[model samples]
Target: MSGKGGDVRELLAQYVTNLEDDVFAIQNLQGVVGAVMARYSRAETGLRETLLREFVKEDKLKLAKAYKLIERVLIAYGDDSVGELEGAHLSFENISMLATKVIEHRRIGGSPIEQSTRYVRYDFKDPERGYHYYCPESLKDTPGEAVFRDRMDRMFANYGRMWQPLNQWLERHKPVEEAVYDLGDMGSTYADMADDKARKVFERTYRNDLKTKACDILRSFLPLATRANVGLFGNGRFFQHLISKMMTAPLAEASHLGRRAFEELTKVIPHYVKRARLLDYTAANERQMRRLVPRLVPELCRSGRDSGIQLLRPDFENMAGALAGDGPVSAQRLSEVWADEEECGFLASLLFTYVRAPFEVIRQRVRRMSREQRLEIYDTYYGERVTRRDRPERGIEFGYPYTFDLVTEWAVYKDLMRHRMGSIQFQALVPDMGFHMPGELEEAGLGDIARETVALAEELFAYLDAHHPTEREYAFLQGHKMRWLLGMNDRALMHMLELRTTPQGHPNYRRTSQKMHDLAVSLYPDRARRMNFVNHDPVFWSRSDSEARQRLKEQALEGDETAS
Candidate 1:
């Protein structure tokens, strides 16, 4: 059988491609099966099918076992599966089972991003390539046989007039069959024959045959819209990727096709299937983070005096008043207050801007210390510049001494923006600091790779600080980038610790977030709380409860192994 639907399997393949670690693939599989089995077993007739006529039931327990076995095998050898299956002289049934295993694994925690249809408004449904109507027959009504005969006579008279030359030529040509064959053999009327030779042959051969030549000429003039579903296919991801590429293509067809496909696929994969979401780095939320966090500010503000705490003086509600907006609080505005040299002398400046007070006190204490002292406290985790300047009014202005790679810059910008603050100040440079650079090698040069490498090294060094290097070194080498930076903040840090630091977390943001968790632990070693980081992407939403449970079981097993 032709695998017309094989394209659908490619999406499943993409999920496997991302399972870079074989262990993760297996753990995820175990989790999926465990979760599914738990849920089904708990139900009244989890695997049992009812027989209507006999009023009996048959258990599908064996099928469920087969499914679990497939899930486990795929997870255990997932990274080597495609190759192993290729080399193994397995039966077609075995290969089919393997495919099913892959799809089943994908269904658990791996699926395509979901998209919304209603919100995306599409406008360009071109008229030149749209709905058309065709009619095959028409007839005339008459009062009587005489009337009908008269009409028929008129029609024949017109037809005879039209065909007079051709009819005369045919009669003169000798044999009717031969003349008819010559007329019928005209190639121009064939839809596929677009060449001038075909047109010329048909025209010359049928010149005396008016009807045939007319048909040939009409065929050449047929609208390009006659063929509608030209390149349509079921490969949505490929279609989506193509559409994304075509949006910028010079050809009208490419752009139109891309935009149409993108819009259509969005309905199915809402989270992952949309156009690129370009970030506005200069937005207020990003600018404000430096103000709220003392480390981000050039000049450290104090809790009392000019920037005094509101708790001591409720009449001075500027801090609370400033933050009480309809939308999110701006980190840039807070950074501006802290960045001012004169603002550092007061208690109110730094205190009220925070949700908690003790954290602010620790920050203020760090601010009062010299650059070296603050570095000593942070244990010297620096990717950027480290410097300090004595401020006549604000006490001191501590700055990041080293310039960071664009990756760090973008990463910091993304993090601060997520905080939704607006008060931060960047230092003036001989070259403009706010002017952005491309993050990718294609956009930048090899220099970016070097810078990124150094930055990543710095991040890993910071991550290794908390653990007993002797015991954890082996696993630490294989650690997800986020696992290195856990327990860096207060509640916000704890929130992530509770959420994303688990074994089955997203890889990108997890490390940076773990750094936040680390900071939290330092501030509140006694009262830290953790939160769960739920995968908000719609693709994971369809997983049954049992699958989730199985995942937990697998994680427990993995965790026990790790402990050993």
Candidate 2:
């Protein structure tokens, strides 16, 4: 081995030996040295090797000195240096309200996997454990605690009651294939099959599907305080930002989470995240909003009223059929095409950065260019030839701007909200717009159950709306419709369309994306053609087979059972 490699191996070995004698500290040091080693292996091999050698050969005093030097350098280097190092997996067990806030911290750029309400049965409870909900520390000694606890208990009871009936309904109405398949048809029932494992697998699959539908219907009744667990994976820099924001957040739960997360994270990757601190700006922003909002528009602050989507710009006269009713409308009917004079000006502004000459000269040159030449330039800028490394020139995309007034389901809106490039204004959640029932639930003969559950939730929401308007949204399901006005350029739309139109995406959002694409094409046919990845098809993709294989492997390790 090379001298550098030998030194690394020795240092690692000594570190391990030291950790063996200090088991408690090993947990704290796990991601720190690993992250440092990874970065050094890539770029700072010589410096890393020298530091390791010095620490391994020197006494306790020297080792402490080395650690302090490393800490100072990391803190001084700021976000860029620490951003390169990843954090260890951090586990969070909290209420759904806090989980949503944590997941919505997009600035962290972390990937999080939370417990699925679709697949997991939250109704299972032990008498000793009690119903799962978070109680704020301030509520402990107050009379309001009794009221809060009683309401939460009632919600859980309603949620539990729906499960059994929903399951029975699904079983009775199993698909025709599941009901009538012969012995040879593996795609359907396994009635003639003698294999116990195959029978168990079939039962498990059907049960899971039934549970998913039931949970989807019942989740509308669940309070924001319902307990949830999430596994977060982020880099050290992301954790620093997350910790800072969480600490500065207005919610008491967020502050509690921030402190707890910081304690655990600092133990693992101290150097990378040592500079994390709550920002004064975040607090000031929240304070200003609270002070200014009610004073300026007291009537606007009223709750429980439906704030449906509205189109303020693009001339109301031009919107013929799109703004007719509250129901879903075709994109073609909704948008107004820009006039020739207006379009020319818009296109010039978009191409402003691309022009090499002065503003007036470029304006004249763009006006003179042939239609074919303009199209050619756009094609060359964002074409099939452009690799991931070589993004299209930003100048070409500056010309196409589109805006839409959208009324979509809360679930669909959540997916769209992830696209940060768009300027979106959302209305408060309300059930007056109605809810959507999944086609799968309808197919399984549980449409009535789904509809009735939403109605029940709306009834409860009405009560909360009158008594506590701010908390009424807790009763909203994924199917509940919400309105939002979206304003974005063509470049943002291209990215949104390419992603949301995939076959794997939810059917509702896929329809939304398809409509958006249609609108774009209707207005700017030449530019719309450049967005090549928008897919609209009946095909579906799933990871169920791989998941089944993994389950089988786990089962095999537990016993001698074999999967056919």
Candidate 3:
């Protein structure tokens, strides 16, 4: 990521230079390699002397010596932290949506950016492959291959067929967007596109908005095998764990891609990821767990079906009695719910760092204690706090975790799952239950076509059930319905809701975020005070303005005087 005379270069950061088919590690930066940095910290020699002895140049090291040092200290001594010092960038192009989920599920140590369906058109066929979806390497040459190919071709064809009517209807329903012919002082965000150049961009943004809407509705007709690109950036430690996990994934594609990633990364950072292998114990344990995993009665799991969101953690009716002392389990539960918000907050903060007993037990004891005792505990614990960074302890985090069982659209679930602050799980993508009918799509008079697509999808999925069951998931459309369960603390919950409910958020997810906020607020009324940041208003032509602003900001950064 090297660039000249910009924020990146100003920071004195340098990137490894490379040519085609060439990838290499950073021998050193500022005369300190990752390998020597470890020894440099522990060495008796002075910094100046260490620099001269370790470096082949003022800011680099001899490649052979650096390799030897890393091999001896990192590989032989089994020092894993040394691997974390170096990072790498990896990108996967034209990967199936199903496979992208497995890689993007990592909660930490990596950041990824995937091409958004909101912005990109998925209707085109690859010139070489003849389709926009991935055909499994395993399914090739089998009887199912012809069936899979035929069905996918029909799915994308239906996707294309619906586009024309949807777009024409959108043009009629929402005509020309308001335009800004001039950018006077560059202070106004709304004045649509300010200057003439930006005006052209804003016009294009309006046109693309129609495309986005049509894509959203028709996306339901495309299958999960739709291919998109993703780029991931992480340290060696992150890749090591990811490589090991993917190598053991049940999907053959996952295992093959894992090997491919490891192979490419080895050329740049070899020793750091040397131990990323599929261990026998790990594979055997997974196999045993799969056998022991019990499937509860499906009907019970499907209770309260057809609804969008259901709060499961604080099932007040089922839990109110157990917690109110009428039953033997009154003094139990994970303290998912509390009687007094203030006291829960106080005790949760006071004895938060200690008190290793059950939370409900502690609350019962809190009822027996005096205010002075609680105050004394709190004061003793936090009295020495001198900065804002002395933030709240982890008790609130553990105390207020909430869970929801939601029947959300596949597209919304895809966006929401990218937020890994919570525990999220979903069932196999299936078309039987029901599907969403985007209002615009129905109004556009394409309702029959949408339903027909789902019917065809169900028919194909049924046939695959007999032939290739797992392969049937590739048949699920973006607007198809699936049940997802999510559990997270209040902080993470609020963050997800606020961010996803923005004016520019996809309508599918914005509605879901609003419902989540309403449910959570109704459950914990006190939380509503701080939850005012949630955006509930709709802004027509929102993305165009945002796009214009981003373009102008980039222009300003690039020293374009006309931008301002």
Candidate 4:
């Protein structure tokens, strides 16, 4: 191994050795390391195959079974939360040996994942590759009517020409019929083969010609998404990240496909996959509120007589020299500590950042609310507007608290502009921002619509390449519409949270609300203190409109039955 490879192995060793909490590593360490390892070793099929075979033989199991054992060993070893095992030294040696080979085989920043746009280039012309099943061409009557048919036909013909020679060459040495049968389909022929055989065949088959053909198709026809998944082995964590994004997203086909993938993966690795947790903010438990308040709003500690006030705690009912009771003090609101836009914005973004645990913590509070309590909380907290019509009943809406909805952000901004807020705060358009605002922007010229959204937040991905070039990273920025709600008070927030944190809520809203909750507690632990009317006190919040809620319940039941 070279000096740099040794350094990496050493770093990895220290990382595992120093991992503090095993439980913390339940998913994070194994996930990050596994992902990093996968990316780093992705191209090193030979090395990976060697390790897999050796590991499997040692574990005395089939490939899948051995893979699981290896995963278990790494997870247990990498996890600091597992406590010290009796055979820690022996296990470490084994893992270290594996890590060394992995590091030795690592490329750029260490990941061996390829970046060629060649072999799978033709895949871009495949509509199914984009995860969009309902192409306008698919429904057309004629076979040649599809936009990609001509290009695809040419690709197949070209590929056949290229592969024909190889097939003939193989036939000269072996059986011609078997060679002809073996190259059934260019890409998927190996799908039916064993991993070893597939690797060996593809290592030879994916020649310059194949890559050239792939690049030709990719550069011409494929969307970025279709070309992205080539030569990749996405681990559970990556899927978790992908699923989180797609869960509440609007792309019906992609989201459905992603969900199905998640379902299948969960079946294979049930212990590793975390099922989505449903949360409702308004119906949050007051007790948890009281407990979490200390962490959220420590300043509340000084608000009462027990806090430093001259409170009378008389032994007798009429004690002469007793401290005077300072009657109930108003709970300290989040604004006391976090009145600034920067702090609030930072928190808002954090909530939407989509880290799971913190997201779930806030989500649980939202999920506990009864249906009626949610709307009442909304009415009490939010300023009534036409956009209130968009709020989903019964389920938590995504993007609550921080911003009700991305659409709501635009609508609210438009309303503000109508009243002349535009002079002070004009909306800027972001170019090529079409993927996010699909339904809303579909009617607008795709390019023009993209131009309407301002690109205030550039992806921080460039930094990843600098510090860890070998690592794969993805990131996004909050638009101005969502960024402005940082300073919104508890009332505006309660309604937002109530709506967004439910299943019926928009997915982005749900994610955003959780982000806001996480930020609130993390940023200003002093002021955001008590069980407010809308947030913690679900009992009272729901009481405001019991009848309207009953009607909603009836309507929902009717709708459900009608759908059935």
Candidate 5:
């Protein structure tokens, strides 16, 4: 075997040995070591060890037996006990049309890293010299196949055609050097470089930024059928729930993906995911909900409207007085205060666990303390927190609440929907709301073509809405507007604002985040003064490009080491 393959085998063996040791330790703790030994002896050590060795040699039995044992114990105690133990991490790749569904199913308890629309350019031709898309099997032999193909082809064609003009327009309109002052060290270094070299670097960055913006707008033209790679890392229990839901989904692609995922997952963690099957209860519930919706509110079911943002509850009264003092608080002071508050809660909860005092008395005593006294107590409790691991308790964040009503493009909504910590309630996905045209498209002189395409999509959406309302959403373009009600606390707001306002974020969502931040500051300027993480500067390259360049550099270093 090659050196690398042998090294990999060694690592695998070490991992398996450690896992087996952990299993044995747990069994001993549970006082089941004797029972486990008895079973192993009955199976005969020679045969059992031989089978295990063969499985290990094949590199397939990492924790299979341990998982099986855990599964058996859990089942014996009742399925409810399964929650006590987290299943093994199972990774999945090449998941496509099901990307949105899988990612948005945050209740399934998994983390998904999907191919970003901002970083990866999907407008290019595939290896097969055709656009990459997910064509439903049901449509393959039907008359609709021709329509689907033609529409997808034209969408990709327009996307490709707009590329050059969009880049050229961006070069003329949004120069990179103009925003160099905002990028700190990187910008200063670039600014100080030789003129010719700086220009070259600047041009590359400009083109990347331009492409991202153009793609953001152009992506609206691409249907949901466009394939996207998504990597999922989640436990078997969550996978079981996800697979069951997918199997019952109305989409043919979802059903196919669910079946394939289930089959593959069973190979690794068979016992834990054995219960993954389509439940008629869930399917019937979905059917009834869909059927009852239109019948109960027929007028609300109608489509066609303009999209925009509306801030519903900007409750600043509670904190307005507290923040009325001097200017915004310093970042250090803000962090100190937050840490202190969280420490107080942590101590209180800890005391509640052991104290003989009545809960109401304890609550009253804590509440009656002077603000200064409380701050001092908390400061002593949390001496120094230089790292995130020493940060404040999560409960402290519940003090700040924010609510917004947003009407943005469907493409932007998809990005925001991934922030599952927030409650995102949305209206129907329809083209009733006028779509957003890409500014680059207008600058590229493809404004007419873009408008025409949107018009065509709108007409088709109208037809679909009237005839097939349930499936009409598939016809809605990315630029189509949809309204959503967002309710989130300060912690969720921090994550959404900081993430969505990054230089690489979609402009539409970036604008939304900026608006949100602006609104928050306006209401509670003192409290939000230190919420300075929002990025308003421009970026030269997408994050994907940056990561790829880093990977190449690392590979070069490895090659040099190997040569030495």
Candidate 6:
């Protein structure tokens, strides 16, 4: 913005909120914009007055004058909160699904829009070999390169080959109109429309439904190597942590992406993201965790079998007085009930982040405190919140936590990971754990083909792992089973269960969501009573029905429903 005059002022006023525009990202001088704005908080004067009077510059902002302030506050004074004052929009295009998932999981506060396999056509397109997949640089020199290429080609080929047959099956079974017609159709305008026009709507919408279902089914065949897009908006602090996390990830793809992201962010938010480097603590901790977890937990060292959705509190409920004081009182709110038992754990949770004391200390203190004290803490923590979206408070890191051992397909894992409000631990997806065979596929007789593709990918994975240990995850079929632990608090669990168990969702995840909800309900019938949104109805061709409802809504909005 040359010489903060009329033109620059008008430009700033016009596009102040639209940070997604490149204009804000490139021209802000990164921290300079945030620094100038942050000054108004500490200053007694208005923004224009602060800029002109305090900075003592009427015409323009000098870099050293404003930039130095941010550097001092953030770097020298060691105030991390200052980093939250600025952020930027970043787009990751045509990256691997693995990379996108890792990014989403690691990211703190960001709205991420990912390329949906349900909506996007998975046709082979562009770049050298007419296939959309990420080939690791590590595989280029190895004999596994041939195996990788062949497996990817075969998967894509089958994905393309099955499209027509799948569509035909959808059309024949999920008919656009019910065969057992009602007399009400005689008065229905949509029913009276020329068969050709009806066919047009059916072809368009049902074709959309077809794309959604077919891709959802065959998406199991998609390897983690398949290229996907993700765009997110995050603050500088978020980027710093996320970048450091990726840099230390198990796969080199994550580290490479992190470096590239760091380089690009330098062009936009250089000062804010300067600390986005490999941290000694992060690398050392992760390396040791990987090395010693098996030794620390003897069960982890051995071959363990899949146990679908087992609630993971070992030697649980043996307490002679476990149920004592668990029953909800007449005056109790849902938030006050520490359903997990022992101490007013839920109430003490609100102080988890704010207090520097250890969580056990807080829990014990709460345990000794009177009922009124815990109630007061609960009210003080959450009562003044305006909306449910206010994120409760800082103490979500602790309090009333539930852990579930999940044996699910890679497809379900990707969907589940979207709820990043909890801690997660997952093992590698190998052929030994097996795949999730959807009933729809088994009924359609393509179940065998899907299994065959997993075997093909497994063979490639074995070949590649033998040659070198890198990029084995890239070979993992999305349907391959892996055991993962999802640890969430009550609110997070409710959100996941209510959302994923909806009829419009994929059947596989829907079932798991139902099971999670059922488990919660069985465990705490009183606390989870309000969780009636959990859909336990029979699901079949849900996309078809969902699309049909959408069509009716569109017709009503367009006034076509009133047509003669």
TM per model? 0.19, 0.64, 0.75, 0.24, 0.65, 0.77
lDDT of 6 by residue, 288-390 (tens): 4344334322333344356667664422333324435757434343323335343445544454333323333445566666666666565545544453323
> Which residue segments of model 1 deviate by more than 4 Å?
1-409, 412-416, 419-491, 502-508, 529-564
Best model number under TM-score:
6
Candidate 2 vs candidate 5: which has greater TM-score? 5
Candidate 5: tens digits of C-alpha lDDT, residues 205-224 = 55555666666667877656
Best by lDDT: 6
lDDT of 4 by residue, 1-564 (tens): 124324333333333443333322211232223322332233454323333333223322244544454355445443312111111000111111112122112111111233333333332234543321122222246432342333323333333333334333333433312221123232323355456744454444433323342232222122211122212234444444344444443233334444655676555443334532221221233223334434432432231110110111112322211222534332343233223222232332222221211222223333344545444444432323343222222112222232221222222222221111111111122212222332222232233323222221122223323443222111121221221212244555445555545542233334445555545544444433331221322121111133224334654686699999
Q: Compared to the true structure, candidate 5 yields what TM-score?
A: 0.65
Task: Find the 10 residues in a row with the least total lDDT in model 5.
Answer: 25-34
The models' CA-based lDDT, in order, is 0.28, 0.56, 0.65, 0.30, 0.57, 0.67
Model 3's alpha-carbon lDDT is: 0.65
Q: Give residue 353's lDDT in candidate 4 (0 to 100).
A: 21
Candidate closer to the true structure by TM-score (higher is better), 1 or 6: 6
Candidate 5 local Cα displacement, residue 251, angstroms: 2.6
lDDT of 2 at 515: 81
- For model 2, the stretches where C-alpha displacement exceeds 4 angstroms are 1-51, 58-66, 77-79, 175-194, 293-407, 413-479, 483-564
How high a TM-score does candidate 3 get?
A: 0.75
* TM-score, model 1 to reference: 0.19
The C-alpha stretches of model 3 lying farther than 4 A from their native spots are 1-32, 44-52, 55-60, 72-77, 177-202, 294-307, 314-400, 539-542, 550-564
Which candidate do you rate higher for TM-score, 1 or 2? 2
Predicted candidate 3, C-alpha RMSD: 11.3
In model 6, the clashing pairs are none
Residue pairs with backbone overlap in model 2: 350-398
